[model samples]
Target chain A: MRHLLPRARRGPAFRAAALALALAAVPAAAQEGFGFGEPEAEAAAALPSAGPASGASVGGELSFSIDAFYRAEDEVADLPFEGLAEGVLEFKASGTKVEAFIKLKLSENILGESPEDMLDEAYLRLYLGPHSLEGGLLKLVWGKADSQGPLDVLNPFDLRDLRITETLERKIAEPMLHATFALGDFTKLELAFLPGFEGHRIAAEGPWAPAQVEALELLGIDFEGYLPDTEGLEYAQAGLRFTTSSGPVDWGLQYFYGRLPTPAVVFIPPVSLSLSYDPYHQLGLDAAAVFAGFNLRAEAAANLTEDLEGDDPEVYNPSLLWSLGFDRDLFGGINLNLQGSGSFRLAEEGVGEVAYDIEADTERTRTRVTAILSQKLRNETIEWELRALYGIEDADFYLLPRLAFDVGDAEIEIGAGIFGGDEEGELGQFAESSWARLLLSYEF
Target chain B: MKRLALLAAVLAAGAASLGAQGALGAEEIVRASRDRIQADTVSSRSRMMIVAKDGSATERLVDQYSLDAKEGKRTVIVFQKPASVAGTRFLTVSNPGRDDDRWIFLPSLAKVRRIAGSEGSGSFVGTDFSYDDISSSDREVEEDTHAILREEKLEGKDCWVIESRPKDPSFQYTRMVHWIEKGSCIALKAELYDKKGLLKLLEFSQFKEVQGRITPMATKLSNLQANTSTSIAVEILKYDEKIPAGVFTPRYLETGRPQ
Candidate 1:
């Protein structure tokens, strides 16, 4: 990975080129009609009352936005070992008949030796009276609860982090079909499906004796018997979500299942562990509530798997995770958010007894508390935000502070973080690392 | 003949009483309407329903606005509803005569855009309300002539009926009738006529005191010919904050985000 650095220097330049290409790809009509579905328009138009005699035509809305960040990390342990920069562009248009969205992301490794990966999303949506169909890379959210499993698109302030790992990896670019039927003002049924790749896959292979190689056996077990084959793997996930809002309270519940593929691996002799591919099952729950200026959210997920291979005797290991957070507006634009979560593996097994025993206590727990002081400097422009985060875990502690400035179509920020811990367990020695970063971004 | 004369006298007296105690006087009412039309700073949100003549409806959330008193200068922001735009923000500022300057800060985009403006009366966001309806916050009353039409009770509230005819042919509406509240000086209802003197739009609603000032709390605007309507419900209202003056500047319009 270190040898790939020299070529990575071109990452930013490539991203810039991609951005330019995307901009050029847009039609002239769209560029001219920017800010069509804006909040200001909604606020202005909503000032009027709803009276039976009033004859006002409902208005349409359109908007375009972009955000980017750059960072430099120093000597961070067990973290991405490279300087990072990321950019996201989004566009939306809404009318009485249709709504659409487009988004793209360009990420680069500044310090490492390889080109950064890029993620792009584009989708067109059509509203057909009672149903809607959207195609292209899109973020599909299912569920009604505010803070726990899904339906957390609103209220950015209550988010644990800007990025949610599970959802980010599940973002699919293929075309998807979705439909919704009104059950009532408080309940609706939603169904969606897409044709795409499954989460991950694993394969098996081995070398044997010349003539009888095909008939070889391992520890009285048939090497080729009952082995699963990997091909044309399809990933599918479906769930039912219900949402109801009464006064200031909103709630949601959902259930979903999908297969995940891990990287392929080779097993050695002494530890006789065969690399078998299997789908990991996940169950999740989420919820949130708001009262006055205080808000609370909680979510939990459990991973269930029974065996690594059918012929090989091995016990299944399961993991459970949960997170909780709270937020309050102290005054003005200043706000505070405190969040924490724990990831625990209930069972652990490996190729050898030594490996299995070592993995038994892999349960990890982490907590983070953050404070943000914000000010609306000039109406909607020139917003200044100062933020600080204190993160603590069983192995280490981290302190991070950042400041961001929004200037017209450009945004810039600078920040630094420090990680510290004493060497004790296997994870502690690696956790005693710290780094600082600076970021600058612009959008058009 | 005697009964007819008596009836005319009674109608005249009823009209007189409606005009005398209504919210705003005829001249003052016009002045307030003009003040809103020509307001240098205004911010509000609206829920719009686009209804086709065939009876099809598209409902959505629209954040409309304008900044600065200069002609062709304003800002407008729209939030995507049902998901993304629940708390989205947008802004627009008009440039001289070319087009109104515009910008939108999206949760997805997290930035803004400067859009060119064209045809003030063109459909706004595919709804019946034209760009003119959004920018109408600052029109001068002198641009139109005012006449007391009659007095009547609208939506169960006593109102003063007044008619206005545009002095400029370029004005989108040829005439507008307002039902001003006798006690609050607020326009409780209004009827807009096209150049041919045909009714084109109707507006009516109620007002609530916000921050010590009477302001429209709910309003509905319907395009009669188009057979569609836009409605607004204010979920939150705040006033007289120390909002920086620069927040309304074109530069600010291009970058402001809720902190």
Candidate 2:
């Protein structure tokens, strides 16, 4: 589902035409598959705080980082060059039945004089008897899927990001109050209340926007604006999750009552020219287990949107989405991960009735597969990885081979990506957008 | 085993008798070494340094917590540093008859995944020590056949050299030889061998007394075949310390805080 932009809330200070972008790079990229190599202790240990000589724990850590990258890609692919300097201050206090944590981020862009994003996360957590309460901003990750999963629905993704340049950890945190009650030894019941909501960040115009727009034209619909706001507490998004572990298997059942993070167009045309985060309900089941040598994981979600019957093409439609994957070590140091994910329209009405060739549309999903193979070498100081994402039905694919070296307190990464197959397919749209990039980051 | 015990008493009183040492069977000596360092809980923060053949080194900060349970010992290791390995946690719970239940939590994926087998023989987080090496003390004596090699004096301390061969063919090491200090019963050194021959050399030093318990502050593992080694020095250590039991679960893996 996709939607239109609401009356523009973006101020003139957005520097919309700046030739540079505010890089959203997250340091979590190099920390793949449990991570390798060693880190210095002097600069890494959490800030010291004296406990009862032994009882209650209270301490905090402050860290600063500088990141710079040089890219050789075309104008529409993304910003040509970007650099950011940021500092993270985190404080943690744990005592009795209470454990609190908060992180404040301060950043400034080297190129773009645009505004800097601040206040990364702040949360206060209390443990009362068998229940827990947490409130403030948080990046809550869910589901068992490896890289991507339709069942991982709690947080909204940063759509303005460029791959490799920004890690998936760039996901925006939501203002939420979450609670969990222990039901048994390996089970817990979770409830969350999200007060503020935002739809997916859709880039106004870029090389990637063409295919999406073209697909709409084929459906005899005109793309317009997008609206991302929802009312306060009374209409707040809410969710419930039941999680349990049995022997070697871990599983969870989830239910969410909220607006779809993505949008459905207001194809009811005459009245409004905007897109919105339509109301929806979802039921999801996810599980993970390691048998033989493979670490198996799977997730499935069935969503009920505004157009449950699929009679309206302009509204969001009901759909079933799922993902299955496994990870295992091969040879001595090579690690392999493979995943298969897919989504299906619940009914054949409306746009589902329109038949377009594989190359004509990228959003028309049937099946997609992703694979990641990484090898640790040079006494685990050097890492080499090859990642692939393919649209099986559309015959479109993207490949990226990257290398990273651990030098002192910093990591140097270099990589190149290539896109091929049907030009209208998701990955294939970047067929001519291929480019190489170099990134250097140091933490202290 | 009785004859060996008698001989061991004889050696303790007067000499170095290899034949008498054999009388005490390897299993009894191993049991003493394993049970000597008794404690309800253990907590420590260590700095690990890995040195390659070229003398280049990489360092890591690690915190380990272990508690003795009814079944066996439960251990957890967390890496906090360099941004690359930060927020990574590995948990291993020992079982009486089974190998172990192992799991790892990586912040990147933000999930706790199981490590299928202890026999995989892969290095523990790129270190020279194998995954099983971290829990070798918890391995049951019945899982292997033991025999005393001899009594030797090295580093000016009397030592009983015992050899243990795994009864299960699928085990990672074919055989292992340990140097158990005569009176203290602490393993000062160990040699591991596979089908190809000697694989690793482990040495423990910097013994210190904490909470009335003798603890080793330094340990080094040398990968003989690769000419690489890793040394871990405990910066802070506490024995019989109180650690919340909740830290053993995945919840602590994400929060780094014990309930």
Most accurate candidate by TM-score = 2
For candidate 2, write residues B108-193 as lDDT tens digits.
Answer: 66666666553347666677766567657656688889988999996998888889999989888999998887766667888999
In model 1, how large is the Cα lDDT of residue A184? 47
Residue range A168-201, candidate 2, lDDT tens digits: 4556667788898877645788898887676655
Tell me, by DockQ, which candidate is best. Answer: 2
Predicted model with the maximum lDDT? 2
CA-lDDT, candidates in order: 0.43, 0.64
Q: Candidate 1: lDDT of B93?
A: 40
Model 1 lDDT per residue over A1-444, tens place: 121012221245455445545544543221112122243343332343311111112221222223222222433343433345555545554444344455544444322423332334445555454334555545554432112232322111111122221333333343455554444433445555544333221111121121121223434434434333423324344445454433333445544444333312223444343534434555666655554435666667675655432222233345566666666556443456566555555543342344333223333343444445554432222345554444444444444555665433345655544444534422232232333445565543
Q: Give chain B TM-scores in order.
A: 0.68, 0.84
Per-model C-alpha RMSD: 18.9, 8.4
Question: Candidate 2: where are CA atoms >4 Å away?
Answer: A1-116, A164-167, A207-210, A213-228, A231-235, A266-273, A350-365, B1-23, B95-100, B114-119, B167-171
**CAPRI band for model 2:** acceptable
Each prediction's fraction of true contacts recovered = 0.03, 0.30
Model 1: TM-score for chain B: 0.68
Q: Could you tell me which 10 consecutive residues in candidate 2 chain A have the lowest summed lDDT?
A: A26-35
